[model samples]
Target chain A: MRKLINQKEHFIKDMLDGLKFHDQKISIIEDSIVVRKVKKESGVAIVSGGGSGHEPAHAGYVADGMLDAAVCGEVFTSPTPDKILAAIKAVDNGDGVLLVVKNYAGDVLNFDMAKELAEAEGHNVATVIVRDDIAIDNAEQRRGVAGTVLVHKYAGYLSGHGSNLQQIVEKVENMMESLHSIGMAVHPCLVPTTGEFGFDLEEDEMEIGIGIHGEKGIYREKSETVDKIAGRLLSELLPHNDDNDIILMINGMGGTPDSELLIVTKYVMEALEEKGKTVHKLLVGNYMTALDMQGFSLTIVSHNDELLKSLNAPTESTHY
Target chain B: MRKLINQKEHFIKDMLDGLKFHDQKISIIEDSIVVRKVKKESGVAIVSGGGSGHEPAHAGYVADGMLDAAVCGEVFTSPTPDKILAAIKAVDNGDGVLLVVKNYAGDVLNFDMAKELAEAEGHNVATVIVRDDIAIDNAEQRRGVAGTVLVHKYAGYLSGHGSNLQQIVEKVENMMESLHSIGMAVHPCLVPTTGEFGFDLEEDEMEIGIGIHGEKGIYREKSETVDKIAGRLLSELLPHNDDNDIILMINGMGGTPDSELLIVTKYVMEALEEKGKTVHKLLVGNYMTALDMQGFSLTIVSHNDELLKSLNAPTESTHY
Candidate 1:
């Protein structure tokens, strides 16, 4: 579980420096926030962030038709209110700023505080808390996971299309209701900051419904075939609605090989098609990942004309 | 090291089935060949393939502006000539077909044999071998690696622009001469077929210049800083010619996190700029990988007007 990084204290600073080269349109500000180099003149800027281990999640989504900026925190840790404030200030044009916060207590509190701070300075700001994880029984307690990427796109599409901040927030709130996601891990990821695995699994055991920050899963079972695993995730994530059309995302945690991700994609799609559901769009790869965790997460969003258009829209963000 | 696969024999089949969902334009035929769903009416079609472990290489390059088809082999093994012939027959649209092959002995032998068979069947065909690795002093012995993707894009750009088969070959042959690449690994990957680590490393050491198939590198040393590692690869790969403008690719070998790759990209760009070289184009991410090997490769190509135009052309491939 050794990492190819310099000092732990400088891990993120060096990473921020590295990220500046990702796109000519993306640049680093305040040594932690990643913002678009060209801020569009007349649209609500969309901003999001959380812990750092989920590579390409918040930062990778920063682009022209995606996020306007991303506030990068420490590994498995939330960014401070000041850093979040900096990102809000950097990308906000004359229109307004929208904060998409994943549903973690640390994130919810900090992002909300930043929204308050910005609004206090006479800048227009709004917040949307994404809690799409369905692993837990209580909806309020479910942590946000890979499904947040969709929220980013949906909001970004609306903003880029010249929708007002209120209109975009209302549409995003509706979309969040139809989004659900769950992930399973064969091996726990090592948290670089802690120098420890988030959890341990036996040789033949796997944790189902784990968190991106390596939170312990709901339960453990012997590792199963790819078909059964995909089936299990689909069973838990398939929406109860009557809409058969849906968008499917098969995301690979960092260390999982693309071969394995491809296998997972086959089984998941087959299961959906067999169940008589139409896969409106399928995105498969490492979009959002737990660091080096050998796992895959299935994210399902009820397909609509707007969501499909949003998903199909071109994005300058490298990973999306 | 456990793989999330059903059976070793079914590995490539399941992966191929799964890859169909990557893009509507990509499809699978003959169970092992991936080709575009809509073949263009004119111009030469480009094809390439090697072993199966390097995901998104040959297959990921199959799109409107890239490869017309890719032959899938077993893990770390060459595709049979029969598979290659099937791909050639599937993609030829009377403009002739060009086969872009990596320079592994098995791949060169099989791809060349397929060209002969295709030509005997009265379908015009030609082959161009890519051996861009600069690890070994003897150019004949170097392995074709991440740099092959550049060749794919270059050749595909030519074909889509209505270049004839001979013109495409002439340009590709000249372009291959300017391509050079090198890679380093922190941890070896697991061979799904053999259920063994491709190679081994100690707690504080890394392998330099390893092959995509996990062939041992030219040497190993104590793990060095990312700056030093990037510098060493650049020292070996920089061309003697005075073309300061160049195209650079920072590729991840499967398991390394995007954060580290970004960090690696920063140092590489800095090192290149410090040398007064201008990076006309820069690509960074997991373009080629060795199963789940934790490493990175740097590919450098002397920049020219045509190469820059080719690199900037759009493609529908998911990973590129």
Candidate 2:
């Protein structure tokens, strides 16, 4: 694919510059180099950071009603502990700070070390590891996916309202238990520098439960109608859907058009309706996306009206 | 090439259903079949709409602080007069409504008729036809591209503040003349059901001044580095640059990533800096994307600090 880039290595820094250019409140620390734009007044600041390819996930959620600081790593790479620690310090408002992390081993370890460093500085710190993906053999060790967005929204609401570190951790932990996510890919994504397709899939086939970092999936099958796809995926997600309401997310991997995403959401809603499940809140867009990958994912968060109300609260950002 | 639809013919309606489902206040008028969401407020309301497939373009922008109502047509097809009329009526709040139309023959004619109908209904109405694209053979009849977004921002800003009909019309008309845009595409986009690419280019080629509606472009050349690509495109756009300050938009056609967009913007900024031009405000993203086509366009609106302030105004929407 043709791309408008100066050098592959400079892509992330240039992107960060443009992001900061568009929103001047966003400042990159010269030493640690975390991309943070908004500041919290007096609360337990919430910080989440990860790779760069997912454009709107961590940083885009940094605004008044969402995350306060987002430290970005290289494309699909975890940030160093120093960068994470810097973000924690930047957003710390004397109350405490919460680190929201995905379940990838690198991300978990890095944020954990950063948490220790923050505590060593005499600042109270806690962490919530979101392991919401259900596409793996070990549900306990499943890597986090787009469901992290819901965690960010809820945690931001709590932090914005001045929740203590313990309260924030407990709330996010509750949300983590209620969310399950799964994804599928049509064509693999190509890394910018190497131009290597992250994973392989046949032209007429799709791989379900694929990792955003180009990891292999659990199943490969011929592509079907979106309704069939939704059924197969949600079956694994909603095993006990008899009584819970859900906040449904139909997210593009990156390159999937909004038309296709809406189509997929159509089936997802139908599947929910068929199971007599209530969809209290729904978001369909490229919330967390891969780099030009042709696929999408479904995230179902079982929640009550309170979580739904919190998710619907308004915020300002370039991408919502 | 894979899709989620059961059949091609139902794609638009299904997507509309998904949009309405997530947005409860939004509904389709059965008689006119215009899709719009009502803002439960007593203030003056603004309505805008256009062709579909530019996902998050018109519809995603129709939430708080932007547009009160957005009417969508079929993929790349203009809405009928009745549809536009319905949208105006749906959002009218006695303070009059403004119609923001991209400069295209069909969009102009249809929205004009809608304005007449709205006026006939005792609802004050104003229209601003955006002719901002610099790629046209004739500047007077230039086609509007993504720079209409600036118009949307300013007009929405004024309308949100309850500006009178005469005030809104004058401001939008004055603003339209100062906006100039130009775009290119690496490949043609497929209409959802057809699954066929609109136009084809060699692996190393691009088409400049490509229309958002798939109109033929002015130039086709071998694709080059981001700097060289920016050089060629800026050359075509600079002759019309005639403002002391300007707002710049480096917009993705849909499929391009932020990594590539910043690279494109780097050269674009360099070219502007060489002329000693000042870009007071900049927006870079998929503002008015053309499906999943892998390409981008540049837009600059010559304006004073007032317009710059309005452009920087906070907006709440799915995509900003």
Candidate 3:
């Protein structure tokens, strides 16, 4: 795919610079990490980061009621430990900072190192891993996907309301248990660094249970209509949806057209409703993306009153 | 170019169903028109719509202080006069209604017919065409593109604040005079209805000044770096800047990844700043799109206090 980037090395920096211009409140520290310009000194600061291709995931969510800082790395690559440390330092207030790390080998290892580094610097930091992608049958290895946004907002709302780092961490940990996501891609995205497609598929095929970094799905199948695809994802999401009132997000994998996203949304909502699921809230858009992959993901989490309230809380986060 | 949709005939209806689910305030009337559920009883109402593929264009912009209703049509096809009439009658209050039509033959013809039909019912109504696209050398044939959202917001802001229909129309018409936009597509989008691409392009070629409905641009050229593209667009937008303060929008043509968009956004902002123009406000995202076209467009308008205030006004509009 033809990319709008200057060079592989400069991609993240240029994108962050552009992002800073898009939202004046966002500031770049050490030429990489994105931190909020005005952070509260009396509250727990929320931070999240991982591979950079997920557009609004970590960076764009840095706002008044979302993330305090986002450590963006190169496209589809985890941030370095030092950059993560810089984000931790930049957003750290006296109350402490909470790091929301997605489930990935590199991200987990780097963020863990950053946490210890921050602790060595006399700063209190709490860390929680978002293993929300349920595409894998082995739950322990599920990669974090769009469901991580809920973790940010839920944690941000709690922290903004004076919850300390420990309290925010505990609540988010609980919320993470209910969060689940599954994705299928009609087309794979090109990784800018390698100048190669994430995966290949026939014109009449699609991959299900795909990851945000273009990790191939567990299996491939002939491409089906949206209704069938939505049903396939739905069946894998929950146990037949028995009276589950959930906050559902129909996340577009960057390149999926909005019309198709909505069409998938209509079918998903209808299917959920038919199966006796009460959709407490519905979010449909490219909340988190896989570069410009043409597909959609379903992020479903059973909603409680607090979760619903937090999800509905006003956010200055660019994509929410 | 695989799409996540059912049959073509059910595309718009299914999409609207999903959109209504996305925002509870949005109500689907006649299974085609999208109107706000809770409308004020005493204020001028604003409405805008065209073909259905532009996901958040007219429909998503319907909210408090944005649009009262969005008359959606089929994919890349104008709505029948009756559907437009339904939107006009559905949103009209005793105060009056304003029709914000884009510059397209079918849209203008149908909207004009709808206005006349509404007027014959003794309801006060006015109309304004947004010919913001600067791609066409001839001003008379310019197609309204991403910049129409500005017209919607400005007029919606005015109407919601109790501006009479005539007052709102006059102000918007004045604002329209300064609004300009141009777009380029690195790749053409697939038209679902026709089962074809919007336009044809080679691997190294791109179409400049393309319309939202897949209309080819005025010229084609070998693709350049985003900085060059931004510069190319900037030069064609305004007359060497002249230290003008303006509101700028970097709109994605659906399929462009967010990373590329921010890169584009960064260059555009840098270019404008270097040209000595003050950017009062900058919107960067897929506000209006041509299906899943892989490129972007820039919309610029010199801003005064009211226009800035109107642009910066808080909106419940979905994609703002």
Candidate 4:
């Protein structure tokens, strides 16, 4: 209700307009689609999108070394098949196009429909569903969260380097197997359309495994200390063995301040050190965020040297 | 307080430890100081600092082409003269050192004392105080706010390009003159030491012209629409003539989400367009912040070709 929007109907479009105004490297296609300004290179073009509320995810990563285009939908809603097809067509080079779909039902269905439509028109398109959220028991039903950004980075990097579609797909699949993410929220975010929070949480309670869409978590309990919360989240993320180094992401679920994020990072790092696990690389920021959820998520991806190199690769993207 | 902190006493130091752990380019000197990991170049070394709550300002800006060192104090408290002197000594190359001080009584006094101490030890040092907040009347007493970051970018770029202390000082002074900033807060931020908000506001009320340290604003009124707020802010920022291009910064005061910032930016851009003013560059993020204040600040700096080029210059800092 306190959001700074002109009209609830134009929230996503207006945000895209503002994004295009600020960043010259990105352009809007057919109002709902965001594509890189530069012409697509002859390689596997990377495209991804879901809802609009999780910013700096799809659009902010649209650059030469990252996503080629991002099909933006309304807040917490999936884009239509036509919009996804348009983004695919806009960024499709001769090689192919890859759609990195999150494992939400609506996103999966719409992106799949778009892939079918694009492939029907003789464009080679591949799809990869990222289900990195460890909060749920069923792997097929797991929701993709902040770990999707890491998937974008690797897929975009490999594709931009002229990797064949199969190679990119294989690498992404391998990366997905090692990735895991889980989030907790102290407050639920409001849906711009309805101007109401998706759910209510008592002031003293916190959701332990909330989804980015304000989805119900595994449990709600009395709010605990940050150190205990970090331990709980890391227990879900860290792999059992210490054979491989990990890349950790301490992501703010949009309303959390950077100061709190750093404090959380301190505890997460300390917890990892205590467990005798080495963090090869640490990323701390709002890479993917719920609109105004006052929470944070911990994402840990087991990484080898090649994956580390891909992540550290230079990117012209403003937010990667 | 629903903050992610360990102990109030160790919050700043622990955050710095996490920063140094994540960013290999920065290191901690003494106990509360952050310096670039690389050796200082033989040119004017830029040093700036105040409180520790403003993440990614003083410390995150310490890199090869930005501040050589940042003297970090406790949360919302200015660094002591001894700490500033330690920072000055650590990053002082043979050429000289330049201290970029914000126009706060505590920061100004401590930095001045550090300058005297450094000069007594036979080091060439110059200081530039940034006072760009348009909320206050007297230019001499105006508090420096988010506009101080722009001063850092210009000053660091010039000093890194091998400008002498005096040349860097002159450019920063000129840059400061053209800079203006104003902030509004929906709620006051809490001080960790006291675990209480600096001020209280009713549910429907907002504070205009709020200071970074939770200082009382010029007025308190019922919260207005974003368009009205943007119009009022621009009325104070834009110059009388419409012939100049300006760089704009939409800074989140810690707790404001990026989505709201973009919406606020949409209206600010529309207002500028209506007034026939051109925005040449836009930097939108949490450049400077109060701890967990749900508000934002707008900063505009009139710039020409040289200043724009300097602002766009490359820097190794993680958050510019």
How much lDDT does each candidate structure score? 0.87, 0.77, 0.87, 0.84
Task: Write candidate 3's Cα lDDT for A1-320 as tens digits.
Answer: 37787777889899999998988888898877888888667799888988899997778999999999899887788999999888888877788989899889999999999999999999999899988887777878889899999888999899878787888888888877788899999888978788788889787889999988778677798889999988889888886233478889899999988889989988998998898889898888898999999998998888799989988898887688
lDDT of 2 by residue, A96-149 (tens): 988889898889999999989989998888988888788886877898899999
Candidate 2 interface RMSD after superposing interface residues? 1.9
**Cα error, candidate 2, residue B128 (Å):** 3.7
Error of 2 at B119 (Å): 7.8
Q: Which of the two, 2 or 4, has more lDDT?
A: 4
TM-scores, all models, native as reference:
0.97, 0.89, 0.97, 0.96
Looking at candidate 1 chain B, the ten consecutive residues that score lowest on lDDT are B234-243
Q: What tens-digit string does per-residue lDDT give for candidate 4 at B1-320?
A: 55666677888877888787778888898779998888675878889999878777778888866788899988888999999998888888788888989899999999999899989998888898988887888889999899888888888888767678888888778777788899998767767678788789886788888888778888888877778888877777675224457888999887777767877888898888887778889998888998777788999888688778877999887788
Model 1 per-residue lDDT tens digits across residues B66-124: 89999989988999999999999999999999999888999999999999999999999
Candidate 1 achieves a global lDDT of 0.87
Q: List the residue pairs that clash in candidate 1.
A: none
Score candidate 3 by DockQ: 0.76
Candidate 4: what lDDT?
Answer: 0.84
Calculate the i-RMS of every candidate, to one decimal place.
Answer: 1.5, 1.9, 1.2, 1.8
Every candidate's DockQ is 0.66, 0.51, 0.76, 0.58
Using DockQ, rank the candidates from best to worst. 3, 1, 4, 2
Q: What is candidate 1's fraction of native contacts?
A: 0.64
Winning candidate number (DockQ): 3
- For every model in order, the fraction of real contacts preserved is 0.64, 0.55, 0.77, 0.49
- Write candidate 2's Cα lDDT for B1-320 as tens digits: 56666667777778777666766655656422433354535655667777787877787777666777777877778889888887887788677787888877888888998888888888888777788877787877888788877777787788667677788888888877777888998766766757777788786788898888667888888877777788888888877775556778898887776556766776788788887888888888888888888789999878587688788787766567
Output the lDDT of residue B93, model 3: 76
